[model samples]
Target: MTASERMKMAAGEWYTCIDDELEALRVTARDAVFEHNSLPPRQRGNIAPALRTLLGAMGEGARIEAPFHCAYGFNLFLGEGVFLNAGCTILDTAPVRIGKGTLLGPNVQIYCAEHHREATGRLAGLEIAKAVTIGDNAWIGGSAVILAGVSIGEGAIVGAGAVVTRDVPANTTVIGNPARAVTPR
Candidate 1:
């Protein structure tokens, strides 16, 4: 089997080769972060190598604050000049790709892993994995919950407390329970 296939097989139940590598990288990255105790400081993402592996371009002037949570980091990709503020959470069961110049407001939860509900009982721990993608220049407002297989198009804004179920188009502002586009800008 291919490396990716092996990783997929071992995502929830067991650990794959990629999973170990990602964990190591997260630990190293977390240790490298400086000035974590200070306030209002220019902060970068406090990545824990033991947590996961991060892919993509996290550019200069980007900041990802503390208490950020995620699954295997290898399935995640962050873009340049992106700011993931405090309390950001990502469950990257599949791949969670974030676009460039995006701003993630505080307490944003991006989850790609989904569970199946059966009549008798719930399926095993994790049912299946899906990918989540947020396009370029997008802004995810605070406390927004992005579910699996959802894509937020480029230049779109997801307002706070929104539960995004479908794909959001580019250059639009979406809010509410199901997250509808409010206006085009």
Candidate 2:
């Protein structure tokens, strides 16, 4: 199978693919520490380099935290000032795009692949990947799981520990497990 096919196959069984992409991504990400991380500590602490490396993995102007994990580095894209706190993980089998100035708190997970539990296509390993986009200036609180095809609009605030399954409009706050709009203010 080709690389893309391998990624499709690795969706449910995520161990090997995530491991495979990590080394190459780390290599590309290592030197970026000098470019983005080698800044004064007083400004934003050590997160700058991490962001720089992640951006490097995705290409230019894609700032991301170093310690973050993804299924495929190339499938994930980051924007300016995208702060991903410690323990951020992205399953980017499809695509995960985080807009500029978005703040992702600790333990935030973004996933793009959805699997079928029924034993229908077990041999072929077919699964669908839906893109997830977080618009500019959105704040995702700690431990939130953003599922596939969900878009969080600009300036939206997602409550801590919320499991987002759908779209959230701009300038709104969402809470609870399924993540519904709590207020429009």
Candidate 3:
């Protein structure tokens, strides 16, 4: 028997995002996210419980500010001491894993979904996905966008408003669009 679209997606293979099962997962995530975002910020204590139900795996001390958005919360994994500021968005068509002690600034966007280069394929609702991994102790600045299949190494820093299209080396600082590494003086 052929595997379902959801199964292929979970395996990090190319699959159509418009599958009914995937749609149902998105709907479930949307409902959870809506409920999470509705909670008053003053009630800080309530956030974790909601996230625990939404996310696939959340380690101790993981905190995401309200108004977070994701295509499917079940595909996101947060490690211990991870902190995500307000207005974060994750398009987790595939798995998105954040390591311990990572910090994401406000308005950061992480995408694990990609479309085919050919317009015809995209028009047919065909899509591909790659897992995104942010290593331990990394810091992603505000408004940074992490594209599909990129891995930010341990202790790496991504400057504000940068667009990362490639893997970031460990302990390096990357800035600007396409995210080139900063030369040490």
Query: Of the candidates shown, which would achieve the greatest lDDT relative to the real structure?
Result: 3
TM-score of 3: 0.94
Residue-level lDDT tens digits of model 3 in 23-42: 99889888888877887777
Q: Quick one: RMSD of model 3?
A: 1.4
What's each prediction's TM-score?
Answer: 0.73, 0.69, 0.94
lDDT winner, 2 or 3:
3
lDDT of 2: 0.69
lDDT (tens digit, per residue) of candidate 1 on 43-142: 3234333332344345555557775666555667887777788888877767788888999999999987666555332323324567899999999999
Candidates ranked by lDDT, best first?
3, 1, 2
Pairs clashing in candidate 2? 50-65, 50-66, 51-64, 55-62
- Checking candidate 3 for backbone clashes, the offending pairs are none
Q: Which parts of model 1 have CA positions greater than 4 angstroms off?
A: 1-57, 119-123
Rank list by TM-score: 3, 1, 2
Rate residue 133 of model 3 by lDDT.
96
- Top candidate when judged by TM-score against the true structure: 3
